[model samples]
Target: MKAAAYRLTKIKGKGMGLVAARDLKQGSLVVSELPVLFIPGKSNDLLVQEEFAKLHPKKQRQMMELFDVNSTHGGAKTPEGVFITNAYRCPLGNALFPTAARINHSCAPNLTMTHREDTQGRAMIRTACDVREGQELTLCYTDPWLCRQERHEYLERMYDFTCKCSTCSLTGEAMRESERRRERAAVLRVKVAQNLAMCLEHSTPEDLLTEVEEALDIARTELFCEPTIPLMSERAMVLALLCKKPELAQKYADETVRVRLVTEGGHKGLERFRQYAKCPSSHPGAMALGVGSLPAESPDLSAAGRVVPPCYSPMSVVPIEGKGMGVVATRHIIRGELILDEAPLLSLTQLDANLIGGSGASIGSLLLDKLQRISPAQRAAFWQLRETSDSDVGSAARASSIFMCNSTTGADDRMHVYLFGCRFRHNCVPNVLGLDTLSKKNHMRYRAMRDIEEGEEMTVAYVIDDHNFTMGKEELDTLLEQRRVSSCDCELCSLTGPALARSRRRRKKMQALYDESKNYYQPGQLPKLKELISLIEEDIQSPFLVADIHTMALFTALEDEPRSDAAGYHALEALKCKMLSEGDHMGLEQAKAWAERPALARGEKGSTCEYYKPLEFPYVDRDPDMPFAVALRQHEEDVQRQAEEAQQKKAAKKARSKSKKGGQKKKNKGRRH
Candidate 1:
């Protein structure tokens, strides 16, 4: 109805073509119209003739006007031959739109076509990039990723014409280089697909990310714009779900939406990306990959007017009688509950004692230099922490002592100081568990080991080892005194003679059972290991120790019988305990897979176990969202809905055409009477 963006006209060598009547921007709709005839399934001479007869007389004339290269090139002059030259393959079927078919072919096309089944089988054409007023609009009929020689040969064979597009017309070294770039892109595309298919099984997230990046690099260099959209989307998902880097995930998602808008107009796919760009954790895979284990916010200290970010913790700093300051819970906290997840206020690497000039004074000066770069509010927070050094020491020495007292080892063995974390006092037997330093490099995470009542003091072990759990009351007190701490006063440490000795004996025996199980597998040891696990749970209630015992039991079960249900159950128990004790760690993904399918632990051949059943267990209490199975089910549902809608539209269109032809037949019969 409205003026078309392009006009149909004749070209000197290429017969009829569509040329832009006015300047058009990228993603602008060029033409939208229902196909003259829609043929369901594969197009053939018989099917095309049957569908063509159902079209209105005027629409049939329009279809006939479309050029048929096969007829002009000494081939059969049939409706099917014309359909082969013009029909666009879509989810609905092979659609033949008279107006869109006029757009000539080019190896490098400026226009892209999308069939919208929701709009009563409308064919929509949009410019992939800007086009000049007099430029001839074109679309690619063959696969755009094919090399130039392949593209030309296919075009000549199928349509009886050689493509003269700029990309296909390159000469000498330029032509060879273009082919090289395309060939490299093809190789990287295959590698990316293989890696993604085997992700977390044979390939790591890093491997997939690397191959995707290389493919994108080639796509951009070769000016192959279509592949960039999906590649960017994949990179964004991998970063958010696998790598657990929200900032980088958001960055790539935003880029993907922007590129898709220019290449393929707005669609439902872009809406998904927009939501992901706003908050990457909302992605379904984020829950499965434990993305919530990482800190939600990472502040930028480089910005102007930067200040110390407010802590989002459940505890408050309060003074103790002997201890200067300590954090206490304001509300009841559950076991495995994330108590504190905060980025470090300041981070400094531990000086290597083996360095040539490493000294106490040198370390103090280095610490002071790093301190000066932080914001003023952050610096004030750092100094407010308790300093254990003598009053006669210099400022740098006092700062170093405060750091030593408060900071904990992080990734790369660096010292990371947290404002709220440092306020918590230490107990030899602690109620909270800090994730291992090597697990997360950016943020320090602390989760409760056991439930605590409101107003209870939140404590963590400054150092946890065999001595903390296995030592007696007197010996433990002596060790704490040597470390410049007070005597044992907590519930476990306050035990006098008999209770303390029994506790020590149970812990020592538990450790011995764990060691024996790991050294060799024996049928007699299973009951002993299970008994020790129950004893530790009833007496110690230590998640780390429980996880260690379960891990040994899992492997022992496998060594006994690889495909037993006990092996799967123990693997799941071990995974759950590790998640409760350490949040997320290396080999966690593999552990999760093995817990779900124990046969994966054997080899590839074990995947075909007919008796195998996936072990089911609730995830850790930290995240309650749908796991991988539910997410996969949702994806399948969406695909099924699209297919059903396409089929419904096709059937409705066919009924309308049949009803119109029946009315025409009745009118002709009345005229004959």
Candidate 2:
């Protein structure tokens, strides 16, 4: 509504945010506002500078004042860095509603964003996930190339602050792992094209027997690693290039053409592919092998660990008050499961991120209304969930569906871009499970853990901070001092001051270990023997000790002695066994040096540290401090080892006696006894 209570406000660690004036519950619709303004870049070259100049000076000043200028990198104008190097954005786009903007920028964002377009050509901003009234709403800008150093510099410049986001908070091995993923992404693009082609070209009827079998492996690998929307377009291209079947290739090519027209508009870089997208059947690259009529592969949803469950989604034919009309969930859900699957009240490509700001840009929001208007068949599900607001009906009706029912992010996000069922934000330690919906209209289905305590605020984690995803003491401290806002004073951090003090100590100690381990690991090299020890220690002590413990062990081992130590041997053993079991080639190569240790020196199968199953003894509940599980496991191992040693000694003695008797037998035979 236009009321002051629903107004957007500035958040500190979180960035420009929205605060709830009145107490709210899990599924309550908090606020809906028309974007203060939307500056269509097509109309103005210097959209930001000129748009501000046109605004009332007071409002202009307010907008300018909110500029997170430090987002620029060395004054570079990359859209992403310029948006928010710190915790904010360039403040120019039309946001039908942006409660999510208040959250700070993090490479690893918990919240998501989506744009909902309705049948009447209207558009709305939506949360892909839930948010709390007081909690800072965070959304990843989802821009590639925003690596650690660049983000830090951008934040330092524009927001006049440093980022303490989890991505930036990694230390030692964690930092290196992050670097690996980023670098690997940069190099893997060309490899993907070649690899896909290799599969198609290298195979013959004598080799693989069929086209589908030949291309399946390549498709599997490429899809697994960062299959953004652009890649999906690329996949369509690959299909046309590599497939033997003309009809199948043409079908995918049509999608590529459609997506390209909607997103990139055949711009300079994209213009090159224009011919291929359109000329699918006759493209120069179409398989000349005459291999058409091969069997087609079924949609391998589970190939990439993705589940594409069948949809029994019900639709609504009513107007959702703020976000237009939609259906809401009537059932509870678990992570990675379907909550809703509806055809968009509307669907098109201009809604894509690339299309939104570039030429034909207005096309993105121009026809939103054409998509969302519903049909009569859904009148049942439609009427079932539509809600109206009394406070300001006009503004509510005009609000963006994404902001009202979903979250906003980039054009191509699978994890963060929510549909209708994203209004309910959870506490860090939540009691309710948030379900996934695949349409513009969905609902928050809250199921009780026990009996619902009538007024309980059902919530889920805004950021999953459990598993203590930290690297070192400094990193832990940095995050601990971050925006850890919580309403629950009953938890450890809020309840006892001394508990926090002890935690800081543990964190510091753990950090010391990480730093030491990082020094041992070589960039792109197989981790040194020392490095293996470090990762294992961190893995073990993580969550159980201060955040820094594991990394600290690795770091110390790396510097103290890279060659050999019992702990180093064991760490290498334990980690390698895990990696090999999990099929991690990189890990095996890195930990190779320590891998040569005696099998007994390495970890045992039934070790106490293995918490793979529920145990009965040393009851973790009765005495949390005592690691009876470990002690008992080790004791059992020691006993077994001793018994084996005794048997070996006895066998050796008997063998020696037999050999002596054989030597004497020759003398006795010669003598005649």
- lDDT, residue 387, model 2: 31
The 10 consecutive residues of candidate 1 with the worst lDDT sum are 301-310
Candidate 2 residues 186-233, lDDT tens each?
444333333232344444322322333223333233222122333444
Clash tally, candidates in order: 0, 69
Q: Pairs clashing in candidate 1?
A: none
- The TM-score leader among the candidates is 1
Clashes of 2: 69
lDDT per residue (tens digit) for residues 266-311 in model 1: 7644554576568766543342233432222222111121211212
Tell me how far the alpha carbon of residue 409 in candidate 1 is from the true structure, in angstroms, after superposition: 2.4
Q: What is the Å distance of residue 202 in model 2 from its true position?
A: 9.0
User: Which candidate should be chosen as best, given lDDT against the real structure?
Assistant: 1
How high is the CA lDDT of each candidate model? 0.66, 0.37
Candidate 2 TM-score, true structure as reference? 0.27
Score candidate 1 by TM-score against the native: 0.44
TM-score of every prediction relative to native: 0.44, 0.27
Q: Model 2, residue 21: what's the lDDT?
A: 50
